[model samples]
Target: MNHMKRVLFALPLLVMASSAFAAGLAVTNNSGLPIDELFASPAGKGAFGANLMEGIKEGALDDGKTATISELASGTYDLKISAPDEGVLCTIKDVKVDGAALTLTAEQGKACK
Candidate 1:
């Protein structure tokens, strides 16, 4: 009975900890251009992973529009935004993401190319 009680007591904490591990990012395009691609990488990794915008049904994320990237683990990340045929428009670094939806605007980016 004591073991069962202990297990039940820890169950909710386990659930909360698991939920806290999942994170998401909400990006708003404000760079005065349509964003054709967006990528997120663990901070300081140098190489970016997948294009987060690939799943969007409306094509490019137009200026002033927002998109959410889900299923990411909570951590620091770097964001790369690009325009169609324009190469990299900007890269935003050191974005801290927790379980809450973190918001980013294009104006926060640097190193346009």
Candidate 2:
């Protein structure tokens, strides 16, 4: 194939490939029962808002579902999660990754009443 033909053909494929895993953000809460139902939200919701994918796993607490950042691009992204209460303490911190295989944790507990 000629250079131009190859470039043109590969262009769409490249874009699609990137878009496939363009999630850019994710969140997970493995705090274990009881506390696990403390909070929930998408991992990217903290910093990027709607620019990145949002997921939540409140597990039966009506909180939400879990969010995974496994679909992020090859760069540095600040993964974060929302807190369900004040002084309650919920966190998903220091999740820096390159390419993929990134995991962020979210936890919350306080004033469960």
Per-residue lDDT of 41-110 in model 1, one digit per residue for the tens? 8999968888877777678877778776555667898877788665656777897877455555545633
Number of the predicted model whose lDDT against the real structure is largest = 1
lDDT per residue for candidate 2 within 1-113, as digits (tens), equals: 69999999999999999886665444343333222222222345554444233233432222334544334555444433333442233444344555534433234222212
- Root-mean-square deviation of each candidate, in angstroms? 5.0, 7.8
* Per-model tally of clashing residue pairs: 0, 10
**Can you give the TM-score per candidate against the true fold?**
0.61, 0.33
For model 1, what is the C-alpha lDDT against the true structure? 0.71
Check candidate 2 and list the clashing pairs. 26-68, 26-69, 27-67, 27-68, 56-65, 56-66, 57-65, 57-66, 58-64, 58-65
Q: Which ten residues in a row have the lowest lDDT in candidate 1?
A: 104-113
